[model samples]
Target: MTEHLDPDAMLVAYDAQLRAHVPPVLPAGVTAEHDGPLLRMVGFDHGGFVVPYRDLSGLDSAELDALIARQRDFFAARGERFEWKLYGHDLPADLPDRLIAAGFEPEELETVVIGPAAPLARPPVLPEGVTLREVSSRADLDRIAAMEEAVWGEDRQWLAEGLEKEIAADPDSVTVVVAEADGTVVSAGWVRYVPGTEFAGLWGGSTLAQWRGRGIYKALVAYRAIRAVERGYTYLQVDASPDSRPILNRLGLASITTTTPYVWSPAE
Candidate 1:
């Protein structure tokens, strides 16, 4: 006989499995801090918490409220931007309203897709003059960061620092691939393979306007997929934007769910 799992229980199991498999690359100064049963980070940029509500098995309302108050104090002390990455299924009894009352603002939602890595190994062909290469050196990382900032309209310091830490912690699990033509990085992406999990995540797939629809992104995906398979990961996951959704669909990945990021800023 099969056992039935409650929806909330199943979500908690999934969240724990994913988090255990892939430890988030917490920013510098952010240390793993716990409040009661809540596992979170504190003392980092404006301070935030992971707040695994799905796994809040032993917590009472008072404990939960204290956790929120702690987070609020942490943010107020530093006067920096704060973020809480909450999932749709993680809606506890009154999370949204409480967060809003505490000054958190919601951001756009993105699809979370997971599937076997085989399809990614067979990415579509790239247009002429476009070629894919894995970046292993600091100089290559700098180039990739520059291209990313150019395409996404942001500074590269955050990404550069994050990548540097990842490389220092476990170089083999992270791969940065860039698509270049005519001596410029027109397209780029990266993947992080969790050491013990079946999941490998693709991130930072940025391409220049002129380079879209030429299969460069797909090729980059393929490159990362190949890397994931090489590292013994069976599944590839991506928090995809609408622009990449159709291509990922073509590659046989299904949308498992959505992730929405809520931000709290000092200015607000």
Candidate 2:
């Protein structure tokens, strides 16, 4: 068995190698601008997003407040839902409180779990009636989108649009997977390999409520881990939700830190 890593040191290394060294994930023709330490991404597949690419370990109160307001205005003028990705180690000692005061609602607090992808590639022992595979057909696309929507209780338009772009490009950087039972998609997930980095992100690991207790979710993670190793990615990372954190931890991924998204939705 592989030894579990020290979470703090691993998170520091991840911030440097993956978060700072790589550009924000965006489709072709979409662009982002850097303002101080903030990266303002526009026209990304899933609306607008703001990332603090580096540590904000030195900002004063006034400056921090201005930065938050600037980000809000940048997205508000574009009429986009803005997501500010926040790490647990973010500076000023009260960043989360500031974000909430700025009308940014706190989303789910997720554990930043990461580990070697190869170890997670063990053959998935799925339940008797279920099968897992890479999704390819348009019919499967719709099914996957529907499954995600049902699981999250949200619309799947952005998810579908993002998946379609990835499918059309076939860039080998992203792959979508789904679990099916009796011809219905019961769970769906995807893995995105970031260029110039050692990490691949596992996202959208959602299963229908009724399919919760089965091993379907674990099977999906294993399938994606194998795919990540195939693409030469050393680490598989995920912002694991509360429901999935224990499962990932059991699979040997370390819960390095907590990450939360502060969302500021511009008036529609």
Candidate 3:
């Protein structure tokens, strides 16, 4: 049954429909620019994100070297921590190696899971004393960020800041949902609806170790899926980490491809 959903085709659709079609609707102060073939979103000061697309099959080693240099120089000049997103199926199979040679550090490789949101929208039965809530107030947002920090073992101030701006700009486009148990946020996640596209993004799903098997994560997915459907999005896409991949697979999302973010930070 799943074979009918061609992973290659889905990947093609992702690059074309999502990456090429709908650019990110960034926060108020950010600026998105088209520098020839690259789609660059800047203004985060600390860094930015870049999307590069092309058929590398025709380029020689020299040309490939030059292209990589150009990308490096472009971001380096800005003194930012830029991430160039690359997919598993992208051409010139050695592209990963080239990125490493250009001072770009590869982050974790994530499986790109995507599927219709309907199957995931059914609310799961939560454990007793657990409740789900769509975060609205600053207090709720802080709670969610705190939960994420505990889960990831890092200061997640960026998560809180980004969510605050997103909510302030367009609350409907960003849904940050959390599962509260006994007045404490146990698990949290968010969904981003990109207007002008059929896809929504699922991000920041993290659960405390004690709440692992209870179904809080699934509830978070369900709530976000419901919100995505309400916003007229057909598909939900997530860059699934090893821990969440199996769970999301059970929810019917296909792991169509792998993606790795090669990050470049300007020299000090």
lDDT by candidate, in order shown: 0.71, 0.82, 0.81
Give lDDT tens digits, candidate 2, residues 53-127: 656757788988899999998888888887998887777568888899998999889988888898898888899
Stretches of model 3 off by over 4 angstroms after superposition? 1-4, 21-25
Maximum-TM-score candidate: 2
Candidate 1 C-alpha lDDT tens digits along 3-106: 22233443343475675232555534556766554566654423454555454435576776676667766767777666776666664647767677777788
Model 3: per-residue Cα lDDT over 1-268, one tens digit each: 2444677777777877777443345666777777656677776634787777745667788888787778788777877788888888877899889989999999999999988887778866789999987877888888887888888898877777767877787777788878888899998888988777778999988899999998888888988898888878888899999999999888888898888999998878
For model 3, where is the 10-residue window of minimal lDDT? 20-29
> Candidates sorted by TM-score, descending order?
2, 3, 1
Clashing pairs in 2: none
TM-score of 1: 0.83
TM-score of each model, in listed order: 0.83, 0.92, 0.91
Better of 2 and 3 by TM-score: 2
Pairs clashing within candidate 3:
none
Residue 63 Cα positional deviation in candidate 1, in Å, after optimal superposition: 3.7
